[model samples]
Target: MYKLGYRNNNCIGCVKGGAGYWNKIRVDFPEVFKQRCKQSRAIGARLVRDSNGNRIFLDELSPDAGKYPDEPDFQCGFMCEIISKENNL
Candidate 1:
């Protein structure tokens, strides 16, 4: 099971769930987030974001477009960092 938390900034509310909860920690503590991302990537899982600004989980990426887990090292940290920074986290 995952835990959830609410973070308010600029009148917007952010709900944390699963790894998403880590975002709060990531803001309060960045080094930890980097380490976690590194570890997750090493294990072949990745965090991604969609056009809707939602985080996407990837265990593997396939050119065939079939359902499969995406690799964690597949540039998740980079995207996460970008989003976090852009969003002023």
Candidate 2:
């Protein structure tokens, strides 16, 4: 997926995926997307948020909704303090 501009190789049909991710999944992995839609709907689980922040079902997601996940910038050599690597263990 790096060649496809995806920062991380996210699992197909990940529940946390947004509409754009699902839309892309619909193209790259249609079967997975379809299965997710059916399953999520059956469980009444809305995995995407609308422009107004209302959670919506995957199948109900607009084709025009959302953008692909961003390539996260992991260049926090001196900025990230969440983990203490200063010890350089």
lDDT of each: 0.41, 0.73
- So what's the TM-score on candidate 1? 0.33
Backbone clash total, candidate 2: 0
How would you encode candidate 1's per-residue C-alpha lDDT over 37-88 as one tens digit per residue? Answer: 6665777455544435565543221223222122121223466667788989
Q: Report the C-alpha lDDT of model 2 over 1-89, residue by residue, as the tens digit.
A: 67776555645566756777778788888899899999999999999888899999988888878777651222324333333356442
**TM-score for each candidate, following the candidate numbering:** 0.33, 0.69
Candidate 2, after superposition: displacement of residue 88 in Å? Answer: 34
